[model samples]
Target: MTLTALFNKSIIVSGISFLLYFSSFLSPGNATSNNARLTSKDRVTTASPAVLVFSKTNGYRHKSIEAGKAAFTKMAADKNFTVEFTEDSTQFNTENLKRFKAVVFLNTTGNVLGDQEQAAFEKFIQAGGGYVGIHSATDCEYNWEWYGKLAGAYFLNHPGPKNVLNGKFYVVDKDHPTTKGMPAEFERSDEFYSFKNINPDINVLIKIDEKSYAGGKNGDNHPMSWYHDYDGGRAFYTAMGHTDESFVEPLFLNHVYAGLQYAIGK
Candidate 1:
């Protein structure tokens, strides 16, 4: 063959060799090599962080549950988190629970989860998962002791004739992420839940000014929102979101977002 023809063949041979070597670097399970310049589309896939919102109520159901779900779903869009809403206790299983970073008991009341399901939930928390109890969530699972303390408190009574009342909230720990950006004090019209056997270890984020409203039961120390580290996990609870209008309130939405962030350790 001619010298120029031989040189051309050699060039083609070198190009093929180079491509073969490069293909090995791009092979499955080997994309992390320094030589691999994989684009995002070529990278291994992962599920986005997700939260499960449970709103099951064997007792009285909240009229605001749908509003609460809508609010969270909107917030999740902006926060880049995924949210799944379910009233079915069957979703409380080892496999399904493992997929979530946080489980929110949104206005959940009465005995929502059965014994086996509750066990699964406990294990989920103990495995470093998060829990967020909203409004009537405090009224759930009265027979489950761990759930009571994990929820920060149990629902006892509220000021009523009517359970919903107008009250002023005091931001007890503004430094807490959940209470940060919150006003030092603000008035809200919702069900101000009275809790029984509140866990003192909980870091109170906001408290209600009993003197500002009637049926003051907890004296001056009634907590409206709180968070704490519990059983290898985190727990956040807020006695807010009782009314549909409350979910639309900017402050209340922010409060719920902050609580979720805290629970998820974001």
Candidate 2:
């Protein structure tokens, strides 16, 4: 071949090799593969909504950390939310709180937070951050007056020594997104908590009929789930989701998904 022709061929070959290398770098097996160039919409979708999950206690009741984690993983796939799970109160710092759009207390109990963490959480909520409490969250931080107030109630007690039998729940707020699709009266098996000093001002979403269980603190008016605006921030709580079975329930999962969406301002 002529020298000029050979040079042109070499240039083409070099270009082809470069393209192949570049393509390989962008392939799925690469560490940065999924980190592919994101469009504006993609960036928005993948942007973390910032959620902090506090699972500081197992309480005296059955602990289901794995169950909570599984549910959270499914929720995080939404691409609009990022979740961090921790049992350490030190993780509740001002900077950490500021990073998150919402904080979730997942099946926690007892005084799991110190004064600093408690203050940081209060400031976070007052500054318009969102809060979500699941299951035994009400059983936590009993001494902190603000915690109970924000939760809209404190765990006074529970009905049914075991939480397997079907029980009736009354839907108090049919219009709320979390309880929207749920029926007026539904039966489900799960540990239902009764709260003390349940702020009547908060919007009650679901309640339990006393006749459905052996012993309940709030009688027939037991509020099992609720949502409200507290201190300029949104808050949601559910007495459901005590077991692995509860998390898999379609209706219960839908309720949780709606609550998480609302909490993240979706």
Best candidate per TM-score, number? Answer: 1
| Candidate 2 Cα outliers beyond 4 Å, as residue runs | 1-46
List residue ranges in candidate 1 displaced over 4 A: 1-47
Give the per-residue lDDT digits (tens) of candidate 2, residues 1-266. Answer: 99999999999999999999998876777745455544555877657687888888745644576788787877787544778888888988898889888888888878899899889999999898989999888888888988888888988777555745568889988988998778899898887676787777678888988788677778667888888888879889998888888777889888987887787777
Residue 238's lDDT within candidate 1 is: 90
- All candidates: TM-score: 0.85, 0.81
**Model 1 lDDT, residue 210, Cα:** 91
Which 10-residue window in model 2 sums to the lowest lDDT? 31-40
